[model samples]
Target: MNVSQPGLSRSIALLEREVGAKVLERGRQGAQLNAMGTALIFHAEALEAILERAREDTLLRSLGLEGSVKLGVTPITAAGIVPRALEILVKAAPKIHVSVTEGLDSEIAEMLRRGHVDLVVSRIGGGSGYQELAEEELFRSDWGLITRPDHPIARRASVRLSDLRDVRWVLPAGGSAFRQQMERVFASSNLGWPTQSINTNSILAIKAIVMSTDCVSLMARELVGVEVAARRLCIIALKGVENQRPVGVMWRRNETLSPVAARVLEILRRISKDELAVRKRVELPKKGGRSVV
Candidate 1:
């Protein structure tokens, strides 16, 4: 009671006001419990303990630290970016359990609508349904041409849309936002568009097709950066066409995030900020290289 006397007195006074009884005494040391006060304090202490325990339980459950979060992402996200980000999330919150599903953007969006994933990491497409979702941009990157290191475009300092004009292409399907953006860019060019284009759903398949055939593909620069750096694929700059697109996180607007989901989102946003900072630090100025405008 000594430790919690002030709180207890406040509680008793509030109770006494409703009950019309004197429940506490003011003294030199502090509040003193009368007979009625003593009895009420015992019950109040017990109730407080129960409520505290209940609150702790609810907090833990809500955070999903003791439960699991279902998340969906596009293939490019699953392959590298998300996995790297999750590694950081695990380090920060080990108790959190996450189940990840990888699919093309359309499929993943459907999954999110059906209550499959608690959150989604995807491109901000022109879809009207996603307009109301709470979203934050994670990264922005320009589209670049990806091909085998020995591909003809690889030798060029900067590849023009005309350079890829006649090449057969392996591309993500029209349903994919990235694919649509690529198509739009090409359609605006003097090259028109690739009639010989093959629509693929798999990023791996696109890379494979580009490697095995005289085909070229476009992808976000960061998505293919590791492969480009390793010399497995070449990322040729798209001179004069700076198509910087934003990758973002989205969650249902009507739904409140569970504790676990919130924690995961926090981790993702933090990682995004860190990645953006690093990108900004190393990024070339607008006059020198591509800008994600």
Candidate 2:
């Protein structure tokens, strides 16, 4: 990289002028890239990789895999599965660099549509608005009620929707699919919704609130598996509250994926299959049964 302070300043000014937005933030410490600058850098890097591939196609082919992959992932998939898959990918193909964007399902799908990301790993369903995107089912996840390990309700043999009607709850945003499913379950059981509720989309914040307070929340079992295994969280076994969602990979419909992206997708598929097999072999506790590690 070459350095020219005056030229760099002029270039930055021109970019800001053309985009009608400030791309950088200047402060006491130093200049830093703002959101717009960060986005520009991401696209610039992708373009650079594309140019490099064009110049060294034969070399890259000989090397097998060498490029960048931009991935959009939902919070749960990012927390539970993506890291492990990335670790395996790095060991298998060190030259295939991966960049991940973690967000809600809708946000990631929009990113995919806008070409901000190469592919997305998220819960797929009808009316998702990305029907034109190609999808490959990876696995399925079921939702369950979760709370702190030592919460008073954690010791119950069985729980009911009516029993939870008055308890404090950490809920997803209103009108979201997860929230709607929970509400349907409560309604079907003839139970009123909780009056005391904290609505958020951040899985980490929800987990923190549940762990430190008495608030209970619904979450995918695999997403909270590590905490449950460590006895930090407990899943309430309530009958007739089954809610399963399909987890999958989504990409642009008519476009071919970059080699690195394709390889990463392959790794994710393999990991998903392995995880599903493991879950099947591990006997799950029955409804009204105590927590099992």
Candidate 3:
């Protein structure tokens, strides 16, 4: 903060030369970070956080457990699993501080590779392209189509993929895992993709759009279980389209997890087991009733 203008300029020039890119724009309005500079600052902050955590670990060793964990999670797990697990983590290890980043699988994987996050909770299959990471399945959830409770399709006894082709839909953008799964479902059903669709990566936006409009979207049951139970949304009864995906905790392979991270992981595993058991109970058929399974 006490840096002189000339010294700051020299530092910026040195960094630019090292990176071989102009990180800042100099003008009458003063120096401003360009896009590349902003990205560099973000990574630099992550590195600083890592160093701070290291310092905390070194100093807190004799005073019992006290450290920080940077965790990344996908939207569904962020909404469903992280809260419960974090609750347990806080109660068990009061001195441990946790930072959470919510993102898609690919985004979180990149963060893990860059050492930005200590661990990630994301989908485990379909060639995630993170060969340097290790993952353990936390739970499995089935994907299903969701719409407003009073939507016309929600009233039907059964819905088909073909029926969805003509409806407005909210879908994830291209190359995302959810989008790929939706494409596979369309291909398997021999139905054309929906022409009227809004593509986005925000789970909250998708849910809001689907619940307020005639649009429908696919999501993990666990993600929307609370909403469905509250009668805010309804799952379209579709046969032969059940797709189960495994969600899990992932960390860099060959690296030992920090004490706080390890403890948080343990809490997540226990919570996931309980969640799976609850899901199984909800999935079980009632007496003299047919089960979706």
- Model 2 agreement with the true structure over 1-293: per-residue lDDT tens digits: 59699999999999999989999999999999999999888667757755654656556556775666789987768877788888988898887756799877788887786666888988887468655688888888776778997788887766767677668999877756667766877777877776789988667788889999999987888778888887788886676665566888999897788777788889889998897898889877643354655
Instruction: Please identify which of the two predictions, 2 or 3, would achieve the higher TM-score against the true structure.
Output: 3
Instruction: For candidate 2, list the clashing residue pairs, or say none.
Output: none
Prediction 1 global C-alpha lDDT? 0.72
What is each predicted model's overall lDDT from 0 to 1? Answer: 0.72, 0.79, 0.80
Stretches of candidate 2 off by over 4 Å are 1-65, 175-177, 285-289
User: What order do candidates take by lDDT, descending?
Assistant: 3, 2, 1
If both were scored by lDDT, which would come out higher, candidate 1 or candidate 2?
Answer: 2
TM-score of 2: 0.72
Q: In model 2, how many backbone clashes occur?
A: 0
| Cα deviation of 103, candidate 3, in Å | 1.7
Ranking, TM-score, top scorer first? 3, 2, 1
**What is the C-alpha lDDT profile of model 3 across 1-293, one tens digit per residue?**
99998998899889999999999998999888899999898679757867876776677665675787889987778878888889888887787767899877889888887788899988887587767889999987776778887787776655678666678889888877777777888778887777889998777889989989999988787778778777787765567775657888999897789878898888888988887788768864322121222
Candidate 1, which segments miss by more than 4 Å at Cα? 1-65, 130-132, 242-244, 283-293
